[model samples]
Target chain A: MARVVVDVMPKPEILDPQGQAVARALPRLGFSGVGEVRQGRHFELDVDDTVDDETLAKIAEGFLANPVIEQWTIRRVDA
Target chain B: MARVVVDVMPKPEILDPQGQAVARALPRLGFSGVGEVRQGRHFELDVDDTVDDETLAKIAEGFLANPVIEQWTIRRVDA
Candidate 1:
């Protein structure tokens, strides 16, 4: 089996309230120096060795990420 | 400034319904050969150069992840 990692992040133009909440709470929690936080989604897929990169990309784009508001990257990782 | 990436994943024993939903939908969507899908959270932090690894680790563990149910890994990445 091959392992594929897909990272989906909100588009740069989008507002991420969850990330902003973290950035705001950091200073109050005694952790400083973090300027901005952007939260996103990560997916790990266990696929058969026969599954090719194109198929993985299709799965990532068509299923794992929403193209309208989010962007995604796909890469094969060591199993 | 430096970029820090924090990946938070549910503990292996925890049920991931979101991931399961995707796994179940993939085959229905005409994609096959994918055995399992695990979904998690990804965070990108813009931090001052002064923020040390120890502090970043604390931020990831104390805030970004629920120690009781999730596990996290922290790494510095090229900006």
Candidate 2:
């Protein structure tokens, strides 16, 4: 089996309220020096040996991320 | 400014319904060969030069992840 990692993040121009909330709460929680906090999604997939990188990319783009608002990267990782 | 990436994932033993739902949907969506899908959170933070790796680790552990159920890794990435 191969392990694939897909990280999906909001596009730079997109608004991320969840991230904003975290950024705003940091100082109140005694954590400082943080400026912008962008929250995103991470996925790890265990795939059969038949799965390839191109298929992983397809899965990331078509199923995991909304291309209009979020961008994603897919890479094979060590298990 | 420095860019920090914090990845928070559920402990291996924890149930991940979100991941399971995605896993179940993939085959129906014409994607196959995927076995286990684990979903997690990804965060990118723009931090001042004053913040160090240790501090970033503290922020990830204390604020970003629930220690009892999640594990997180903090790393510095080039902007």
Candidate with the greatest DockQ versus the true structure: 1
Q: Worst ten-residue run, lDDT, model 2 chain B?
A: B52-61
TM-score of 2: 0.95
Model 1 regions more than 4 Å off: none
Q: lDDT per model, in order?
A: 0.93, 0.93
State the TM-score of candidate 2 restricted to chain B.
Answer: 0.94
How much DockQ does model 2 earn? 0.85
TM-score of 1: 0.98
Candidate 2 lDDT by residue in tens digits, B1-79: 9999999999999999999999999999988899999999999999999998788888888889999999988888997
Q: Model 2 over residues A1-79: C-alpha lDDT tens digits?
A: 9898899999999999999999999999888899999999999999999987788888888889999999998888898
In model 1 chain A, the worst 10-residue window by lDDT is A56-65
In angstroms, give how far residue A19 of model 1 lies from its true place. Answer: 0.6
* Backbone clashes in model 1, listed as residue pairs: none
